[model samples]
Target: MGNLSRKKKKNKKEKQKEKTKNNLIDLQMDQENEKIQKTIKIITLGTGESGKSTFLKQLSILYSTGFEESSRELYASTIQKNLIHYIKILLRAAHSLGIKMQEENIRLSRSFFAFDDLTTQSLQAIIQLWSDPGLKEAYERRSEFQLPDMSKYFLDDAERIGKSDYLPTDQDILNCRIPTTGVNELNIVVDDLPWVVVDVGGQRSERRKWIHHFDGVTLVVYVVALSEYDQRLFEDQTVNRMLESLDLFAKTINNECFENKNCVVLFNKDDIFRKKIKEIPLKTCFPNFTGENDYQSTCKFIQEKFDKIGRNKKRVIFYHFTCATDTESMRAVFDVVSSTILQNQLNVGGYL
Candidate 1:
């Protein structure tokens, strides 16, 4: 009986030691997890020029100090270069389409390629060409070719931007066109949580790099150019831009890596979409789209399309109609987004 009692006591002591070891291991794991969660990883995905970069810039303007004077000047130079390129694209498209430019405007178009800088003469010429009916027609057919959504915005401000002492405004910086080549990241602290926002190139060729950034991604901000409903992809003109974005969103959410991760879809460029629906019907891309050619109806229709893609997913998806260039609007929108992210993180961490 004494020997049996000793054996039982030894077993109980060993079990207690084992239990203490497990508790320490779990405590260490929780600490490591807390450290990992300290920095929230956010990934932005969408088709090229869907305002992904613009959204990042907005976050900087809202959360951090905005662009410095030197940065604004750099963007001014880029804007000038982009303006020249914009007109050149229009001119090329008009020529290819056999759209007749006025004889004087034709001369102006040819001269555009030679002058890299936007001078007073060039700015005047740009204004003159913008008035040309042929270029205007090319602008209308912009979807068939590659054109930045901000082409008109920059073109309209050509004279102001060409001034000798001109500096790019916040809006100009927001609307500037610079293709994200690889992965671009923004580190900012929102509501005391460190956030690392990863923006990858949304072009077909650049999408392959996205998977490398998928690890530890807490949230996905999938931007979609709402105005692109009638547009075609830059890489392949046969593919509708909106459809490409939809296909990408489908794959992104269904990817095993992104399973159960919350996603926020920003139906970006609402300003353009609201105006575009009046001119181009959404049915041009989605033929089965029976919704009226109105802003609310079309937006709902597009949201539903994305919603249908994510309906079966266990994760929550939120949608917002965003005009990325509008600072105040985006700030308000991101406020809600950041709060949702915080709550979702807390719930997932079992802190709720």
Candidate 2:
């Protein structure tokens, strides 16, 4: 009887100990997980067609934001690719059957990943505000989310603010401007992962304003348009100014700039550039960079020249990209960006 009683107690003790160990493990796991939430805050920055939106959507769905789980957006790249493949088949099938098609209109959106809704409103309202002629010109010169001329825009509001004839419309954005501004930070993230995203990824020249919002970030993606290589837009002299911005961006954010972690390149319109190269004569980052050394017949040659000399200068591992990139190509490039997060973080802020 004594022996049986002892064995029962021993078994009970063992079971209790097992339960305690399991509980401890669960607690430890909960703590370990928050490390990712606290340590990393990824931000997206790029020019258009570089796939920032698609990639961001992927991330959002993967992580399962606004849904109780990991990204309720419910997407798998391969599945999406397959669906698109079938859609292409359908499109072709319809075309063969003498079916006419209508143009599909698209809408765009970005997030700020912040606490208040101000970031979202800031992006949307500022875009609306910049519609003013003079403000738009200033924004083109310096791409920022700064408030527009309230005097010109909110003439009545200025009067309500106890100020009459305030031609210097916005007192807020003007206040933020400072002389010692070699570096700018436009950090718009929340909980180190960004709950919202309000990005201005188009217009390579305006990419300069990117640094203005870089105080806090965990990841960055740069999108250089290969389409710009194949198709030249010479009517408005916008390309020249854009080239200037690219050169300056390259100069400031050197190779050593991004500590090699959480940064990647989306070479947009890569396929299109290949098909459209005839239109683009100058393939270099800056066409009028006035380099007596480098030639600009092709992108490969330009990258090669920059590679040899860019070694002494800022390195351009910037991938070639296209929104219309094939499945195989996107797979390769997407992996490249994902792996970059494992490298070192880039210098996402300041002039350099």
Candidate 3:
């Protein structure tokens, strides 16, 4: 009888211990949920190919577990599509330049160029045409026409993409050009703070959809390609790309919906700009300016151009020169951005 009483007391003590442990776990989970609820939403805004997606990829690589297998497969498909697009661009350039091709090559290029839909057979035809020596000659002469900056990258991979098994590497995926169609969001935990980074399409057609996302945005990261000063948009050749970016920046900051939002202006593609600026002067793009053809002067001039837009605004604008593909540089920049956002959040007495 005494032994039975002792067993009952021990069981009760074990039950109480279990209950206390469970309560602690529940409390911890509640606190974690609260932290998640207080997440910050950051929207990335930029012109097409201004490294928005690349920036997101860097975040995933550094913070998250990286993309899943399915996403990597999707990126592979994009690489194949990029190959086809590259071939089409080359064919169009050749046609526009009145560059004559061999009879067979011309026939293939014309058929592929005219096709509205691409099928397995059409893809095979593209592979064949891409392999021809005549097409190679045309590609070699691509400098005569205004090809995309990414054209050569895709062209070099055209043959590899036609293989039965082709997987895209992280670098290839980063370099691949797939225009964002709509709003894409990536959730990440940075410095124990839940962060939702949103990427939207940057084309003129895509701007209309941006209004819906401005309701609760905490910050805006606006990216512009510094090397685009001498280029024109692919959709509208008449519009100078740099001028278009400036106009877009002006409109974005001046928008009433985002008046209270803090902005980070990223002068992206600095690597390309550093190389190109030496060959092409800033005066070529902005005639009134008479700055030295060095990197610092040119970048300062561009920053001032953007700063002029925000002179009358009440919000704070932070500027960063970035090469989005460079992981180390982006990491440092993102750290600064994280600190700025946290400080702003505290100053505003809540999340912005």
RMSD of each predicted structure: 7.0, 19.1, 7.1
Residue pairs with backbone atoms closer than 3 Å in model 3 (clashes): none
TM-score of each: 0.87, 0.39, 0.76
* Predicted structure 3, TM vs. truth: 0.76
Model 3 residue 236 lDDT score: 86
Task: Find the number of clashing residue pairs for candidate 1.
Answer: 0
lDDT of each: 0.87, 0.39, 0.79
- For candidate 1, the lDDT comes to 0.87
Give each model's clash number: 0, 38, 0
How far does residue 342 in candidate 3 sit from its true spot (Å)? 3.2
Candidate 1 error regions (>4 Å): 1-33
Error of 3 at 146 (Å): 6.8
Residue 207 of model 1 has an lDDT of 87
Candidate of highest lDDT = 1
Point out the higher-scoring one by TM-score: 2 or 3: 3
